[model samples]
Target chain A: MEGKIRQILKDHGRLSIDTTKLAVDSDLYQAGMTSHASVNVMLALEGVFDIEFPDRMLKRSVFESISAIQTAISELKTN
Target chain B: MTTEFSSKILYDDLVKFGHIIPVGVPGIFGRGAVFEEILNRFDAAVSRLAASDHATKVHFPPCINRQVLQKSMYIDSFPQLSGTVFSFTGNDAAHRELSSRLKDDKPWGDLQTMTDCCLTPAACYPVYPTFTGTLPPNGALVDVQNWVFRHEPSEEPTRMQAFRVHEYVRLGTTDVVVAWRDLWLQRGLKILLSLGLPVKAELASDPFFGRGGRMLAANQREQKLKFEVVCPVISSEKPTALCSFNYHQDKFGTIFNIKTSTGETADTACLGFGLERIVMALLKTHGMDPDSWPKPVREVLWA
Candidate 1:
């Protein structure tokens, strides 16, 4: 799941750095992921996980890092 | 009023007619005499609308207090577009070093410190912070004109970084504010039509940030909380938004501690006109020569 999430970030996050080198807890925005790119990442995550993020989870913080996104995906799965 | 010029021609005409003076910047420019005349006429038209309405007219500069901006949560949504004011506060040695670097064409801006204020993002933003504790009998209607800034840099002349917005804000009950917004939406369309530009009011959304912003934008449209008077100045296929009508349901009231006469949080609505965009639309619609414009259109603007 982590590797797949990292691959999704690599595909859509538009980060300046290599996502593989960054830790799961690293800040995506600080790594140069723009708001537009973040939206693309969210859409890609939805497609990959086969789950839709609720309106409440659609915030900058939720897409802040791989850990944050994984946490959100876990929550969505639980529900 | 029936000209078939592209955005490029319209942009050149603005420069040729001395309506707009383009500086080196992509989105920042200096307005000339004719542009100022059109701006004043637009202001007069707005004044005529509020003649008997007795709205409190207020004016603000291009910058806002940083606290107000943070309280308004502008940074949360548009952190990329917000331009905080910064000033140089270097010591003597630092200043000498900066001067030396300047001689060598080095980047000296990094020595500047962020100030307590930032450029104003919206015309109505400063108004909310002023309403600390409020609840008049009928609520408040404010007429505000302010120079606003956004960091979107584009070669398109219509999308300006620094521009003026003339707005009328109504803070009251939801019913009254929504009604007022609807009324202005119609009136705005009529006013633009009178100026001889083909315009239409359509449901729209603020450019919110991230994936969440998409949901928020969808919600805003679903709730019919935002609309724009768009014109085909830049692109005929996708018209540009000249004016916007937003119905912020108790967001500002809750943040600013504003209450209605009945002690409920007051809902707020505003209609904003992008003064430059309107002028651009008029020029695009009426051809480069102002005198060659249709008689009735000239009368509506000049008279």
Candidate 2:
């Protein structure tokens, strides 16, 4: 799940640094991912995981870090 | 906080004094002659302050191309606030059905089809498409004034559904755009001060919609990308934003394909003065009668 999240970030995050080198808890927004880029990342994650993020889960913290995104996707998958 | 009763009272007073004519809408109204005169004078004062900038003046209709709006991704962030133009593009039978529904006071919105245009949400929106090519070595500065629309219906007199914005747009490098926005924050505050407004500049964010929008707004604020000059128009506790300064860091440049003379994606910044809101602030601060306004304020506006 972590590897997949990193791959998705690389493909859509538009971050200044390599996603693989960054810590799972690192702030994606601080890594230079803009709000517009974050929207694209959310859409791409939804497509990859084949899951819909409910309105309650659509927040900055859910996509703030690799681990946060992994946890969000895991929760949705289990549900 | 401005209560509903207070909002209504202010609205009623403006109407009673012939400042705004209520057209039976919560946020839509017709400006009276006195209101128009004051609004125009304030707009002129702003223009005078920006005269040294020598921005290229351009005017656009209230509606913008639908495709441009879609590409700008406004709907993704502010779907609730967007207003799309719809028209009755039906055949004779459909038109008759629509007319019958309207005459019968039934729901008729289903008959209208979305057009290729949407109401302009911001005065600077139409200016981006015009700068799609490339900027000169010195970059580009543009002056535009247009009626912008938002879907939020409110009883607050300052929150108009349709209002005018005197906007200045700057497109250039990152440093240039950021500096211009910062400069305008002070300049806008100074202009309001000259009018005797008790205004203050503070970091602000757009009213993005929904849960995702909360994150967007936080990110925008964290980056210090937006600021506003606010004053107590209707509520002393909650001031109204009369002018906004925004720094769009290569967002418009990337979407509009705007390139700098140095061959990099251009950065963009814009400052918009809410003309109607300013006039409302003026009325609230100096009573309804302009003649009774402080002498210095009158001179700055009327002179």
Q: Tell me the tens digit of each residue's lDDT in model 1 across B46-140.
A: 77866787989888888889988787668877887898999989899999988899999999889889999999999999898677676687888
What's the lDDT for all of these models?
A: 0.85, 0.89
Where model 2 places Cα greater than 4 Å from the true spot, the runs are A10-32, A40-79, B1-5
For B161-280, candidate 2 gives per-residue lDDT tens digits of 999999999999998888888888989999899988999999999998865677678777877889999998777789999999999998899899999999999999999999999998
* Candidate 1 wrong stretches, greater than 4 Å: A1-79, B1-5
Q: For model 1 chain B, where is the 10-residue window of minimal lDDT?
A: B1-10
DockQ of each: 0.11, 0.31
- Indicate the residue-level lDDT of B170 in model 1: 93
Residue pairs of candidate 1 with colliding backbone atoms? none
